[model samples]
Target: MAAAGSVYEPLPRPCAFSPRSRDLLAISGVDGRIQVWDTRVAALRREYVPSAHLSATCTCLAWAPARGIQEAHQKKRRKSEAVDNDDPYDILTIGTATGDILLYSTVKGELQSKLVSHHRKVNCVRWHQDNGCLYSCSQDKHIVEWNTQTYKVKCKWKGDSVGVSSLCLSPDGKMLLSAGRTIKLWDLQTKEVTRQFTGHSTLVTSLMFMPIRAAADSRSPPETTGLYFLSGSIHDRLISVWQVRTEMKQKSAVLTFTLTASPVSIDLAPSDSKEEPMKLAVVCRDGQMHVFEHVLNGSHKKPLAPTCTVQIATSGGDGDSTPKPVSILSAGFCPDKQSMVLYYGSSMQPLFEKLVLKTDEPHMCLIRDVKKTLTLRKEMTVTKVKTPVVKAADTKVLMPGIPGHSATVTAMTVNSETQEGKRKPGDQEDTIEDRLGAMDIALPKPPTKTILPRADHFSVLLLQGLESCDSNILNKVFLINNETEIKRTVAKLPVHCVVPLVNEITKRLQGHPNGAMFMVRWVKAALVHHAPYLSALPDLGAQLGSLYQFLEMRVKAMQKLSRLNGKLYLLITQIGAFQMAQRTSMQSSKQAKLVYEEESSEDEEPNKEHNASDDNWEEEDEEAEEKEEESEKEEESEGSNEDSEEEMDVDKVNSDVDPGNESEEE
Candidate 1:
């Protein structure tokens, strides 16, 4: 099975097959030989030794479709009576390591033109469809345009200060984008620079421009096509999809995407007609090629997610003889063959793999909107799928029909139940293996994020904390005890993640008594205390505002039903307090009356006995009464003086504090 998908060479470049016919395949070897294979029998057709003839190593290659062959033949007949048209001819252009571009015909099996202009190695060569001009970039910091027909240098553009690592010509050929210190968009005719995109931290290694939607064949090319292009870097390990604005002045590079692993190369499987879908395949440094569904709404640049990833994992043998997996050097998708070809190096030979793409709608990648995604997930969904119930194992695998297929989750994971039975008691694998084993046998399982607790947990907390009715368990688990903690967590959440959480949070808060007041206070604190903090986080405060707004709207709707509901509740509370106060006052008055009655009764008996029995004693009693009155007055005066001191302290306190701090009730 591996032998069918794998072809062997010594250099890492996908074999260029004839664009017109799928019969011939071209492979360049490290031994400096280019071999043509007949795809019909999978056998060698012919060999050409370009290094022996030109004395230079081949760096890059491209196939140019022969144009007007019959017309050229008729013109040749006028120059000479004999015309040779039967032999198969290939207008192949190969960039060599020795500062030269070699143009040749495979049928004649000889070097046609040794096009030389660059002072350093030629990095890439491509023939633009619109201008019929072959463009080559080199370490010499120059892009030389050559005549595709005459094989002569037409013009040289020194656009970049540094050597151009990668370049892509727009389909219309009016604009050119080259990557060096930065990604630059250039005007072809006026030769003026426009926008410079510096998002990537490192030099961009690869770039390609593709249409967002496949245009109808009946419509003209440029007007009906899409404007988005993709770029990838080695150090950044990111793929950025940039779109050209409507004006085509090259001022704005609206970013459409940023994802993917360390990409070694990328290829687009564009649809030939509107009925088909567009697919983008990225070959990463890891021995995997990820496929994403590229979709858009009209001309708008939308979200991009990978639908699935496919990898070749058939490494065996040992020691120095064993070939470790190498980075994918190049990959190309040929719709005619319905296959994706990936090239990489191995021990003795370069590995050429032809993977069959499942063109059926079910397996094809799909695009989604920007704001749609689960809040609890850390990774974005690159591809969405419908996993059929597997009665045998209840596991999903890659498409069952793709050519040279094998299991991706590995045999160990596929039969983990049995493997677990063999393990020692209480033994556990390390974190990495434990995680890998836990993964489902699916292409991608969007991982749950650790930033916020589980959505279910959060929702439950919201319901319990916001309720006017209190439940202990719900209060502890769901309540945001510290506003600062809530702010910090919310600040880190992505906009897509924040919106859904806020919706559920606001929804719960809306059902509570005084929920609107609670939300208003919360929003006010966030905006006032943490305004600077929230400003650092994109769209965080806005999301919080959304929560407050939802609560406000719900509160307003309730208010419309009864304007005095809050006032009525307040009145009920006040009445309860007043009744309690009256009950306490009545009890105190009764106690004082009983005490007075006891004192008066005791004194009444003593007063009567003194008045009747002793005339001399009456004068003495009057003197004693005067003495008691004097003592009582002095005691009363001392108490009043203490009360006046307490009043003075209270007045000093009131004078010292801010007037607004002392809230007065009317």
Candidate 2:
């Protein structure tokens, strides 16, 4: 595994495979570092640090389409100079948490431009192949289009309230698809939403624009046929396919497919020939690859199921040298559509793997069972019988079909077992006699069924506690087990035990308010870990009803307490102000007394010869000291007045604070 400060970190977004070259890949790290990798050699080709600040986290990454760059340069005058430059024409764009879009030159290994417009983190970015324009959506609820040449916002529009989590551009560059809390298709030319898709239960995490085939054998390319797209969500684990056509008379219905895990990325592999079926590649959060075939044609009214599922497990000789499940960060089909590239593993130990798909018929077998079987008749008839010509002793022998003995002869039967046990003439003697003194051939047998204890010890303990209906035991069980252990225990619990556990939690919430928070945590963990089971159960409704009631009561109590706390705070502030005013008054009075004492000491000093001169000075000093004392007394009176007003305010606040009401309710 890589260390903390290593170059490799958990990828903020899956590595972006260059649309131009199959060998090039762009990966953005959580630490704002971007590295372009060459898939052919599995080595880093260039690294670009978009920002030197360590806090800048990368959120999204996209590669400028090769066709876009070519078309962009075709309009420029100095074509030879542009072609001769050392930097590759393809640009790698990376979005950061600071809402800055960085365009980096692949060959030069440096940033080309940093576009800043949005105030929140950028979620998705895409480059228009035909216009060389950049489209970006952010959490700021703004979808801005940028002119690549000027590096400025060309246009902007308001996105969804939940923020656009993903974006897809149509091939014609006239429409844009945005997915967030909902999926909406916008007319880029008109800058307005034309269609809105509903049915997703969670925020959409990914969007892909898939082109519809013009004909089964049409020579036109797949890129030109753009009228469909796919959207997926994290929590729902569903992929919905939608078709867009203004001429269609019927309302477009969404075809939804369920997935084992939430999809993180979706890519389309359009077949070049009719024999090859169109394939959809979906990479899930759990590092699983689900490939669905023949789903894009307009023939089906239902969602197409995945044809195959593949999981990439970590290899040995790494950290612990044990095979473990790797979480896939990103995955996509290669340009050839015959293989896939996968980025998986922990942020600290990120790894890359390539899977070569078997698309040809030779590698795939349709026959599931190849075993051959034979049938035989119950009876057989002999066509001819051969008779042995024996010597004079067999002259009186019966015919070949004659029976020699009765079928019910009472005698011991001897077959292969007896013949095999018989010792041969050349067999050697036994090596030694068997030891019957100490060792016996007959061994003691174990009990058929011993009572073994249950393996889920904590769950068993919790069940016992619930069965006994003891609050203390339940509380002890909860306190001893952490959240992870509790979740594991909940998963191990049988389906029947969940309802009782929930009921117990509800009881605890009602009877023991002090432990309500703990009980709530337990219930939340249980539900999160075993939601599929608990949701299907009908008995859970009653428990959840009581649970919600308790929550509502608690909420009301909290509101009351908050109001009381505010009133008490006001009282405290008022009392503090009063005490401060009194303290200031006391300090002022002490200073005035000290001044008076000093003046009296001067007056009592013995100065007979200079008494006449000192007498005049003493008179002036006494007059000034008397004025200061008068001013200090006035200040004391003002302070006392302020203090009295503050005391009244404090008393008024105290009158409003009613702890008795809260106690009674409790």
Candidate 3:
């Protein structure tokens, strides 16, 4: 069994490649120092050390996505001379053993911000590509999701009682895989465990997802819903590859293969062909890497064997005949997937090497053309270094606040009315006794005018909200107060609060646009109602001048926007007119076609009428010819009958003649 103290021992230096540029690698060193190197040229780019005392070493490192780089650049107000010229806005996140996460910038070569939410060491950190959300797991059994824009904890949940030692996010960014004694997959949206694997006997140290594009089928769309992941445990000397399917709804994770090695880190290189599985590289503690070619070929019934095992040898010895074997700390593939960068050796003098994959030979796949990129040296120290503190001018340090208003409290007591000097009652002699008795009589009290308090409820609430310097509370206060109430509140505000109010408005004007409109109105009312009081204080005038400048800039922007809107409107109008012209032309063409069709029909109708008239005349002429032929035949018959007496003889003769002629023709 391993010693219990081994669990709390300092982890190796964490290193990671930039998500955007594989040539840029970030490695953490002792004393909370981070170093960036250009792997392509084997050159050191920048090195950053935290100003505060760091007792713990970095446990993990991750580079923020390119989108985060853009965000950092956009948020920057001014350029720093120390910023790197080539890559001016790169951010690297470092997780330390103290359970604190530090955001370091390559541009400024300094720490950007420190986040603390864990009591134990942070084990792993992962970034989601789409939303730029950061997920971190720690030995405190806590998983925290952070919003990169605000650097605030967006969500926190207890992942497992044993504590998570590693984390990997799915390609779709909907599922998360965390490894400890048992590997568990979580649904990020519901924060529920979707699947669990208890194959490993020891804590899993490294977890990585297989590249989705490498396994995608060309016949279908890329399968981002499912992926294979590799998890390694140092104590067990085992690397297990598991496959998740169907949006992480698989009843169980299919273990594709298990490779044996005390893996310090695991990385996968996407393959070019679907027939070939991704190349799995596992860097072991003894400076040995096991490269498996067909480990994730989708056959989970049996474990696949590694294709090649490469040994990493040490560079030189301290004037000795033989050098000690190198101890690899971490290893990761390059962007091209053809080579890898390795960080190894002791922390006192760490070394970096670029290992290229050589597939030309069958037996020896990894070629060690190790290039010495950069070396990190550490010096032992205990004293804490304090940065010099410089106090700013009084004007800069002064913050406006409401001063207490003072008023005198006077009470007048009247016991009796003045008596006439005529001594009405001449009772001067009766005197002292009468006066004392008259003074002793009680007199009715005069009516007192009520004085309202200097501040109203809304004014008090607004003042407290502003003084708290909380935007949400101040926004709520503004939301609840009406325009009349706001005006009254500003008017009642003291001379001291007036400047601060203006300053707050000016600062807010630089923020969200929705609040700026109301803030402008509030500032306007403050200046108008308290002009005399503000003018008396020169500092107040400076604040007002800033407000004016901001408003002027906003006005110019609004005017530009208005001009753009007008141009857009003109374009839309021209398009509408063009469309209208097209419709008119089409309608005219259709009407002309209809008219031409009607004229053609009219011409055909006249031709038809002329042909009908010609047919009628031909019919009349044929009828007349038939009648004339019939009359002629009847007259001939009558003439023959009149000569019947002679015709009998003639008919006989004709018949005889016809017979004779027929015989002769025959």
Candidate 4:
């Protein structure tokens, strides 16, 4: 719907793409008009106003999968008992301001049922694909599950939030995510709140679950379940991706990273085949639909960066002329995955190549060949949807919830064939490079044909993000675990880019114990790998020269101080020279005594025979007696020494362990 000179406010939930046909788009309008359009051709297929919807506005719409006759045939073949499946959903479910749900059949082109669903405006309705259940929530602060076939209430429960604004369910129908006071992740089977994510600065406006886009990369661990989802906020203008791992003992959604965008609608673009990288389409307050191709870094598989972006023009208008910029309510990618012929990884990274179709041009062009920028234009058609402007006197104000206001999006949710419970990217923040990859710029992407950002741009963005991060995160760049990666990055970085980062690292590492070690290593790598590049940049070469001079001065000063200290030590040793000279004299006297003893022994050897008979016999007898006494004394002394040693050891241990012992301090 369009109004001239006035902003269009789309419903909290506006448009949905058909999962069955993959070509049909069902859009709910404020004028209670449900329009079906062919997504493939961008042509209006049909328009219908449900008689059951009495109100002026259709709040939300969801398309049920196309029901086939095969189910009935199988039932008959198996001889199973059954009643009529009245809810053959080749149909659409519409919620309106009158708290009523209108189920209209696309096949029959008529309303199937008008169920009075809630006490107030029906906020959202979702068709559970797996369990074949329909779920709806409202301002009544309750979520009700309806049996799709019977249109009967299966269950209803009061919610914790005063008004539940949005709802999303897991693909398996075993989990429910509700957003209002806060975002709550609930286990459907246990009927218990499993986790609550609290960082949304405002009311969570829209949310969708996506399997990790680049999860096919080899580094991602085998997962237990695919429970990753993205949530967007209004006041914060932030999008947060979360990973919830169950099946493991760990049970909470870990916030991976944040993107700053004034998002209106977000969805994934339909891929050509299962093996293709997931393409994400996000529509912000800006009218352009930005389609980013998800690519995993080859060095680190878990790191996800939109290496390429292809923006397409989509607005709210009929065919034949340019579409007008209407408030995008919501969008979804078609279920059909298109197949195409392609070649990659031959000097081209998946992150580096992107295909975009320009509005003026009929052909798709590789973004890499384009210049530095591209501008998006929003063109309106000749005819417009005339929505009446409400004057104060023309419409009654109900003043519901203090006369508040409302919130569009488009999405394609892909199912990852990878196993469940794969380790989430957020869990492996073991390196500074990972966090650097996580850091996002606050600046909106410039309109451009070259979606592939220069590596230098990435470096500048990383520097900016690091500049604003907390001290702990800032210090991560210098950490030992990341030093190797940091050096490798430094080796490849242009000198101009490295300058600011060097300052940042130096500032962060000032006075750090390992600062010198890392700096030495970093300098070594830079000099070795980047010498030629640095030499070419005159400014960079001069800066290196300055640092070299500073280091040389420090080294010279240190060497001089060491020499002076060694000379002072030698002077102090001169005081002990007198003791050294006395030891030398004692050594000479000992040598003379040794020579005399040798001469005496030689003379005694000959004299021993002559004296042997006389004095020698007497002396021998005396000597024998003396030897006996000495031996006896030696035996006694040895025994005493052992006893003394044992006693001393016991005393020493006591002293070592005693409470009052002074030696224990030493």
Judged by lDDT, which candidate is best?
A: 3
Per-residue alpha-carbon lDDT of model 2 for 1-666, expressed as tens digits? 111211112213546776634567777553335666666655555665422421255677888876354324444435544542543446878886567788766644456678999877788899887878999998788899999877889999888876677899886788899986678889888898888887665557688876655667687766555467778875567687777766652344456666767676677886645445677877766556677776455536666667776665434432556555545566678877778876655432345567777634222221111111001111323221222222332232111111211111112334574578778899775544445433456766998999787844887877777656666766778774377887877787766566668767776677666777677778887778778765543223223544655676678899999999999999999999999999999988778554333335554555543565764887777888999999999999999999999999997787579767667878
Task: Tell me the tens digit of each residue's lDDT in model 3 across 1-666.
Answer: 111112112345577866634667777664445667665654556765443423355678888877453444554445544334456337788886667888776665556777888877788898888888889998789899998777789999998886688898877788899986578889999999978877765567778777556434455555543367777775556666677765545444465444444676677786655565677777666556667777344546556656766655534544654434555666677777777776655443455667787744433422322333222222323222222222222112111223421111122333354344454554445578788796697766865986676544767766776666666766766664377877887876667566667767777787898877777678778889988766443223223544665666778889899999999999999999999999999888776453333335577896687677885887777888999999999999988787876868887789777887777788
Ranking by lDDT: 3, 2, 1, 4
Better of 1 and 3 by TM-score: 3
Error of 1 at 424 (Å): 79
Q: After superposition, how far is residue 422 of candidate 1 from its true place, in Å?
A: 69
Clashing pairs in 3: none
Tens-digit lDDT track for model 4 on 97-150?
Answer: 656788775544556667765867676787777667788888678888887666
lDDT of 2: 0.64
The TM-score of predicted model 1 comes to 0.45
- Encode model 1's per-residue lDDT on 467-536: one tens digit a residue: 3234454335335556665555455443323334444445446567654444443344435544554443
Winner on TM-score between 1 and 4 is 1
Give all candidates' CA lDDT scores. Answer: 0.57, 0.64, 0.65, 0.53
**TM-score of each candidate?**
0.45, 0.50, 0.50, 0.43
Q: State residue 211's C-alpha deviation in candidate 3, in Å.
A: 4.0
TM-score of model 3 (CA atoms): 0.50
True lDDT of residue 109, candidate 3: 52
TM-score of 2: 0.50
